[model samples]
Target: MTFEFLLAFAMLVVASFGHLGMWIALYNRINATGLKRTTIKRIEKAIVLACGIIPLLLLLIELNQHGLVGVLAGLFGGASAWSWLTIAYSVLAGLLGIVLAPFWIMDRPHFAIARDRYQVTSAEDLNPLKETVKNRRLYLRGRSFRKMSKLPGNQIVSLQRNCKRLKFKNLPNDIEGLRIAHLSDIHLTGQLSNAFYRLATDWIAEQRPDMIILSGDILDNEQSLHQIQPVFDGLNAPLGMYFVLGNHDRRLTDPTMVCRKLCELGWVDLGKEQAMRQHQQTTLRLIGNEQPWFQRNPSPYKFEPGRTSPGNEWTIGVSHSPDQFAWGIENRCQLMLCGHTHGGQIRLPIVGPIVAPSWYGTRYASGVFEKNETLMHVSRGLSGVHPFRWGCLPEVSVLELALL
Candidate 1:
């Protein structure tokens, strides 16, 4: 082959990487935007079409010309255009943000008041208890999408249970030794069977947590709501089963219906609300913020540590997205729980998740993060819009509180 041909091939490979990065960034922005579902869907379709058609057209043009100039120009031009457009968009967005900065009000920081500061004692990884469920029925739309994307259909249906033991020092004596079983993003739909959720709930029950909190994404669609109600009804907790709606939950045919069903099943619908629970002599405040994509409430509630009666009062924040971690810090919440990123649904070693659908990127992608006197835990989530998971495994977090 000629030197010119080799150079053209090299440029094509580099251009492919550039195009992939650009599209991924754009998709992430689309998810973070507060656009209507229909609007977002249309934009997504347009992106796919543009990405596919442009590359194909360039290839066809080069093939027809059978000339080095045509091949080189087509590949290099596409790459340069992608790079320039990305730069231009970034610059424009930054300028607009600066212009709008004056209108934005900064939230005041709220510091946690602890009788004694808490420190981590032990953190150990727990293996998942694997269970396989078989179903022959084909969910045409979902199955075809998975097949086209090369996502493992079997892995999506399989259930894996994991436990996390968290110990905190200086935990209030009254509320110390509190065990919470946290689960999130159980996207029950045509892809995941009800039996899988049943098995998960059973395992969670076995842990016997003092409180059970489901961060969000309970149902993929309204049809699965009734089917999964019985399974959720079976969950037993002294403080009761509590839940906050995720983005998908709000998209149901009737969002109110899902909330009503959860209430009927004896679960506390904590969506955008706060509740206080007393166990023994201790008092704990639970705050739930749904914060759907289109309707994000910046400050759901202002928590003041000094405003509460002293002694044994602890506050915990629950939301669908870990993006609320900042809010938790500003509200003096001791702990915040969430699970919307789905741990990117696929993680890579060392580099971590390539694409986490969050405004903050992979900063709070999964696991735990500590800022000031507050702690936040983001679950990998039990299920997702897509069934397949790669390096990231599904989990049920069992956080046990302890005193130093």
Candidate 2:
């Protein structure tokens, strides 16, 4: 290509990335909001359309105006070659992140699968292929959108029941082997047959967990709130069933009604209340943070970052979003449990989970990450606002906390 052509193309590429990247950053924040579902969805569509057409228009404008050199000069503003080095560096880093990601299974912390992997099907135990065909006809208009979008896949219907043994420095030796069933993002939208969720809880009951933590996003539409009781029939934890509200939960007509229904079912409302438990003579403090949507109430355990509680207290934070992880670490919360991203609900090959509703993008989409004596587990979650999942599957895990 001629030098001028190359410069024009490079300028177009940079401009496209700039616009797309800015929209993506905006989307990540917008998705984290608890705005009206219809309002946010409209914005999402507009942003997606802009991400596609804006670049083509930029190329046309550059060519039509023949102002490539002038624009390029103003774009860089005579910056040093050092500035362009970032483009090369980010390209290399992104490539490595994709290709080397599969091997992350090796880098992952030591955790046993423990036991059980149930192939959860519909209440009738229908074939998965048959279910897919039924889904196509279910909610014709909206269903057609998600199905034709080819965004995520049937993995949403493919429920995975896993029993994992997670090790942590904060897990007291006495409390080691404590089994906690972590459930998140069962977006009861009435789209998926209730049977799918019931089967998931059946597996949980078999695990016989000491505690059950419902991380968040339990309801997308308030109409589905009624299913909570029937679906969670067999689930019970001696330490108790605790939950925090997620952003989607706030979108409901009455978020408090959701909390009230769960409390009626004997679950603890950790979203607004504090609870402490005693196990094997050790103190376990449970803290709930539902920021960016629901506000956090005053509690001794809630402190500013860099401030900490006594080391002996095992503070486990239950949040809907993983963003509060840094807050958990700062307050000496040894373990933080979250589920909001739904494991990106659509992870691309190599690139991993590209879309997550968080200020941190997809950094902590799901899985266990540890830092400075604190550990956090982000659940892949069992469902989503849209019943689509590509490479990722819905998860219901029994986390056996073990001492490091």
Candidate 3:
């Protein structure tokens, strides 16, 4: 055999052993007691055999040089490993079930609270509803505020060194005093009353922010859009109101039309590939890379961070998830704002978020993270899935970038 063949054989041998090792470990560790010992052993054997077959299959497809024929043969052979395939699928389904099961079990209905802080401000003003909807409306209003009333200020501060201050050089001396209200992931389930959004918008208006940046995941469902549209009409800012798509928003039908509806009311969609310059000086690149359902090899141009005049302009990148931290770092972003994970949705007291989906369970679960020179701010977000926020409270971040 040639040197290339020999090398390929060695790699396949190592891969085969590694795959077998994993199966052996699982067989010894897993509690397969109720099942017949012979059955368990057979399953483990099949897993090991499939693992051993993978490298050979890959080699057949990539190195055999027979092209499609070899690829087809490998794929067919891979699928033929029924025993391992069954177990593998079962494991995947179990993991998925674990992840999504929480949403169903923990769906917070309206009107399930003890505190009066979140009660319906105006019962007469509540939106008209169908018979069933009218009954559920009362329940929804009850859970609106829940434990939030007990929290200090109903606002949680995700304090980190990165949020200390953002450095901007050419932030127009005239606009140097500009303040921005940044909010994201306001998953407006039925539990959140229409009055809450109105109150939030009114409160934001009172702050008199120069600009409003709604990062994404505004409404949780189609019904929420109707309730939210009125509240959005109440929002007003000097510069503009910008928004991007979140993972949840993309899951709905006619997402583009939804974007259009918001845009018709002066809300900028800021799709996957769009940039908006501010004050004719700084550039803001908004990338709407919806999460949990990533596209394969999406064009890099989707988030082209145009070159900014150093010491003359500040470019801020906005995204829904901080999953693209490496991309931001590569492009030399001064600041990136994002929200998702909702500070792990439910956090423990001192131990922090039990499981922050992104960042691999790091305390950087929320707030700002400073790596070298780049600053990434992951907001605690504005609303909770349920009213059970133990440690991490909802928030609206006021970010002031100063020219230093």
TM-score-better candidate, 1 vs 2: 2
Please state every model's RMSD to the true fold in angstroms.
7.4, 7.7, 17.3
Which candidate has the highest lDDT of all?
2
lDDT of 2 by residue, 297-323 (tens): 636475556655554567788888888
TM-score for each model: 0.75, 0.76, 0.56
**Poorly placed runs, candidate 1 (over 4 Å):** 1-15, 57-154, 167-169, 294-301, 304-311
lDDT of 3 by residue, 1-404 (tens): 45644653444444444454344335433311224445655876776676567545645535445356554443344322223443353345445445533542342211111122111112111222223445334324544454353354333212111112344544556556566677887766656666555545666677777777787777666766776676677687767777776655654665665677778888766554455556655555444444433332223333246754454444455667766566656655666777865776566554455444453333345666555445677776766555555566566655666555
Please give the lDDT score at residue 373 for candidate 1.
59
**Candidate order by TM-score, highest to lowest?**
2, 1, 3
Lowest lDDT block of 10, candidate 1: 104-113
Which one wins by lDDT: 1 or 3?
A: 1
Cα lDDT tens digits for candidate 1, 49-93:
876776676556455654565445544543223234433543444
User: Hey, what RMSD does candidate 2 come out at?
Assistant: 7.7
C-alpha positional error of residue 131 in candidate 3 after TM-score superposition, expressed in Å:
30
Best by TM-score: 2
